[model samples]
Target: MADHAEHTEQDKREKLKELVKDARIGMLTTMTTDGKHVSRPMALQDVEFDGDLWFFTYADSDLVAQIRANPQVNVSFSDAKQHAWTSVSGSAVQTDDRAKAEELWNPLLKAWFPDGLETPNLTLVKVHADSAEYWESAHSSKVVTLLGYAKAAVTGKTPDAGENETVRL
Candidate 1:
């Protein structure tokens, strides 16, 4: 039983990484000083997930300011076709590490900053994940989901929604 629990956590962490890797764009939600949640789509910096997520943004951006004011934040990723989704809750910190930025930098990001790493106001936002919860449907196909719904309707049973698990980083 103990082994099973440990394996489950290991599996969840691996699954979270896979999901995030495929869905590079995540909705980063930050809290406003007035207590309102503001979410914006941010491109995930290319890096291996190890309980931390990095993103490139302008130092003077509203998001950077918000994180400085309130470190708590949430990042959510979704792969609709795979029926996989993950929500990560963490504390965000803004860093101006040129070496790290240069390592993660690529031509695609040049669209946002023509000057690349030298672009003024370019900064990296790091999210230190405290915990993450993910949901993955056993049946990834839309057809399978529809069949499950139809079967449930005919048999008066609840459809199998999927699997949900929370793991602490």
Candidate 2:
């Protein structure tokens, strides 16, 4: 039983990485000076999850100011097709690290920054993730998940819907 539990925990950790591996966009929520929370869709740079999340944005963007005022932020990703979702809570800081920016740069970003790496006001925002929570269906297939719901409906018992785990960095 102990071995099983250990494997389960390891699997959960790997699941978090798998879910975010293909997730290119995440909703970044920041607190404004007026104590209001605002969210914007931001493209995530580097699919690797190593306790930090990186994003590129204009230095003049309101989010940069919001992060300066309040570093606490939330970044969330969802994939409806796979019924997986993740929420990451962290503190963010904006920096003008040109070398880091060049390393994470992608040609697709040219759509936003016409001048590419030389774009003026371009900066990097790094979020030091404190914790992350993710949920995903436990069943191997949607058909199996649906059957679980149907069984619960007939038996009047709760369905084995999925697994949810929280990881602390």
Candidate 3:
């Protein structure tokens, strides 16, 4: 029983990483000082090399204030089809890391932060994903998925969700 749980956790972590890698945008949920939960779309940075997600914001923004008041946050990443999604729950930190913020800044982001390029208020919102989970709907959701068959043929592991697993970090 313990072994099975361990394998499930391991698979979840791996899947979570993969989902995060594939999805570029996510809805970040943060609790405000007033105790209201606010959610907004954010870009997923450091995806290719790490699990830590980075987002750029104003140093004195409302979101920054909310996050500072409550560091616990939930970040959700979903693919175009929304069939695959990952939710990362962890603590968030607001820092005046201009270089890192610039590294992630682009022209598109200027629509919100007009001074993103030059404003000293530009800051980095880093989420240290402590635990995450990936939920993937079966491709066809009819008989069985083609990916399942492919996995069995290649690795000899069962391709069914009955054989599905999750992993923890």
Candidate 4:
């Protein structure tokens, strides 16, 4: 019984990792000063799921201020090819650690901060995901999938991403 429970937890972690691996740009939502939800696309940055998700952002950006005022934030990621998606709700905290920021930055981020890694605005945001919900379907057009899933039952192949997860993000 313990083994089965452990397997279930491991499976959930692996599935979450898979979703994060395929997810590049994700929507980051935070509460604004006016009490409205504001979301914008942000890169995955890196996978550090010992228990948290890591992200990079400008220290002085509006999002940072928003997070300061309200730590709660929501993030969403999707697989363009598989149409699988995951959303995480959590608290966001800004960091001033230069080493961590340097470790996560890439050349592509130059577009956001031309001043380079040394840019005074450079920082890392750690998201302690309180809970996550995932949603996926082989394809949203259910009318088209009935025949295909039936065919797979005979041929034996992997089903599409959506067949296995719930969607509420």
Candidate 5:
């Protein structure tokens, strides 16, 4: 039973990585002090998912302040063409590790930080994922989906929703 649980965990992690591999952006949702949910599109950094995700932001950004007050956050990814979507729940922390910042830094970030890593207020946000839920449709092709909908409409039956699972990280 223990072995099976471990295998399941590994399988979930692999599936998550595969789902987000090609996604370039994710909606990062955070809670504000007034108890309002704010979501913004964040560029997904180019890194392997290993129970943690990283992003570069400004120290003075609202996102950083919000995380400082409330660490809980959700990052969501979707791929319309592939009919895949995932929502990752985690806690975020601000880090000042220069080495890590350098490692994850890329040329594209220069637009936001003109001075590169040396840019003032530059900071890293690390999200340690606790769990995630993903939905993947079996009929990924457009034609198949249309056909499924058509069949469902004609038969007055619910359309096949495909697979959905929640995994603990």
Candidate 6:
């Protein structure tokens, strides 16, 4: 296993990217006006992370209003097959950056925005992630991990599940 101290900023960013690359969907949590937290699934826009996450939404969405009220948010991704999970904390803002929209655009998004890029109220939420924490199991296979767990159970010792680290951007 690799030591946490050995990972540089670039290494951490790469690791985080690797963990969440396959997780196209993530839950975005935002604070409401009443101080309550609301979470909804958002498609992770296909773009180089670079310490930021992007999502497509409507300009009039409650999410946009909430983000305007409080920029602090959290986005979480999980991949059961890999036994990996990641949570990113950041500040978000709504924008209509056409260039960025074009960069991250995919045809599948047409299902949401019926008129494609011309869809009225179409907007993007850019999340400037401050940090991310992730957990990943050492063994990717369920059978292998179960066996390891069984071995630990029989031996009454802790199982070496995996590595977990928090990376600051």
**Cα lDDT computed for each candidate against the true fold:** 0.88, 0.85, 0.73, 0.76, 0.85, 0.91
* Best of the two (4, 5) by lDDT: 5
**Where does candidate 6 clash, by residue pair?**
none
Best-fitting candidate, scored by TM-score: 6
Compared to the true structure, candidate 3 yields what TM-score?
Answer: 0.72
Across residues 94-116, which tens digit of lDDT does each residue of candidate 4 receive? Answer: 98878887788798988887887
**Regions of candidate 2 where Cα sits further than 4 Å from its true position:** 1-4, 7-12, 47-49, 140-147, 150-154
- Per-residue lDDT of candidate 6, residues 1-169 (tens digit): 4588988888888989887777779999999999999999999985365778889999999999999999999999999978999999999999999999998889999999999889999999999989999989999899998999999999999888888889888
Ranking by lDDT: 6, 1, 5, 2, 4, 3
Winner on lDDT (3 vs 4): 4
Residue-level lDDT of model 3, residues 1-169, one tens digit each, is 1235555555556666777878888999999877889999887766523357888877888889988889999998877554676778888999877678667778788777787578657788998877776667656343356666787889998665432333344
TM-scores for every predicted model: 0.90, 0.86, 0.72, 0.77, 0.89, 0.91
C-alpha lDDT of residue 78 in model 4: 83
Higher-lDDT candidate among 3 and 6?
Answer: 6
Task: Report the poorest 10 consecutive residues by lDDT, candidate 5.
Answer: 1-10
- What is the C-alpha lDDT profile of model 1 across 48-67, one tens digit per residue? 55679999999999999999
Better of 1 and 4 by TM-score: 1
| Pairs in steric clash, model 5 | none
| lDDT digits (tens) for residues 14-115 of candidate 2 | 677778765668999999899999999999996555668899999999999999999999999987777788998999999998889989999999999999
| Between candidates 4 and 5, the TM-score winner | 5
**Candidate order (TM-score):** 6, 1, 5, 2, 4, 3
Best by lDDT: 6
Cα displacement (angstroms), candidate 5, residue 74, comes to 0.4
In model 6, the runs with Cα more than 4 Å from the true position are: 47-49, 150-156
